[model samples]
Structure formats: C-alpha cells, structure tokens
Target: MSTVACPDCEARVSLDTPVLNEIVECAECRSELEVLSTDPVVLGRAPEVEEDWGE
Candidate 1:
C-alpha cells in the first residue's frame, strides 16, 4: 500500500498497487481522483463524469 495526498482535501490516502489512469474516490473530500503515477503515488482531480446519451 502507498500513501498519497488528495488534491482536493490534501488528505493522505492509501492505495494498493494503484494503476495509472485509474479513478479513485477520495475518502476525505469525496472527490474523484485519478492515478497519474504509481511509482510515487501521485493523484490528481478526476475529470467530470458526464452521462452518455444513447446514439
């Protein structure tokens, strides 16, 4: 497990074998976060999720 700081709340979050481009929810601020890097465990705010309309 690796500890990372949440971008939204700066809260330390623990992740296990985090993969790049994976989305994770912050437990502190409840913000969606994306795993940018796994080497050092870097997190960034995830992009807004939009509903897809049936084409």
Candidate 2:
C-alpha cells in the first residue's frame, strides 16, 4: 500500500498499485490528486509480515 498527500486539500490518501495511474479526489477535502509518477509508492508501514499467504 502507498500513502500520498494532497497539496490542494492537504488530505492523506492511501491506495495500492492499481490506483497507481489513477486520478482520485480526496474524500476529506475533495481535491484532485494526479499520480504523476509511475514509480511504486511506499508507505512508512512496518517492513515485515507475520502470517503466510498460502492458506
């Protein structure tokens, strides 16, 4: 997941890769956020996981 800040509305937005090339409006302040760069975005979350995905 990735988090981006809206300069227009100063909203903290969170999204995944699919939302990468998308222009979404900030729900908080209704500002347009254009994902300018295709570079993968990363949030400052923990870099580790505990559970396995093979269920």
Candidate 3:
C-alpha cells in the first residue's frame, strides 16, 4: 500500500494500487480528495461537482 498526505487535513492516506484521477475521501477531515499523481501518490482537493443546466 502507498501513503499520501491529505491536502485538507494533512493526514496520511493509504491507497492500494492508486490510479490517476482517482477520488478518495479524507478520513480525518472527511474531505474529498483526488489523485493528482501516482508516481509518489500526490493528492489534492477534489473538484466540486457542478450541475450543468440545459443551454
């Protein structure tokens, strides 16, 4: 398993076979996190989902 720091809480987050753009939640802060990179397991805050209105 690989470990990365949470962007929001700075807590250690473990991931098994992490993939790029994988979404995970922070156990300490309960914040959504996204996998920015997999080489060293970099993590960042997940982008908020926005609803698209019909144009």
**lDDT leader:** 3
Ranking by lDDT: 3, 1, 2
On the 0 to 100 scale, the lDDT of residue 8 in model 3 is 77
In model 1, which range of ten residues has the least summed lDDT?
46-55
Local accuracy of candidate 2 as per-residue lDDT tens digits, 1-55: 6777766655687776634446666678766566666465422222233688787
Model 3 lDDT-worst window of ten: 46-55
Q: State in Å the error of residue 1, model 2.
A: 0.6
Clashes of each: 0, 0, 0
Candidate 1 vs candidate 3: which has greater TM-score? 3
- Indicate whether candidate 2 or candidate 3 has the larger TM-score: 3
- Compared with the true structure, the alpha-carbon lDDT of candidate 1 equals 0.89
lDDT of 1 by residue, 1-55 (tens): 8988898888988888899999998888899899998887889988897888965
lDDT of 3 by residue, 1-55 (tens): 8988888778999999899999999889999999998887899889999888965
Off by over 4 Å in 3: none
Model 3 alpha-carbon miss at residue 5, Å:
0.8
TM-score-wise, the better of 1 and 2 is 1
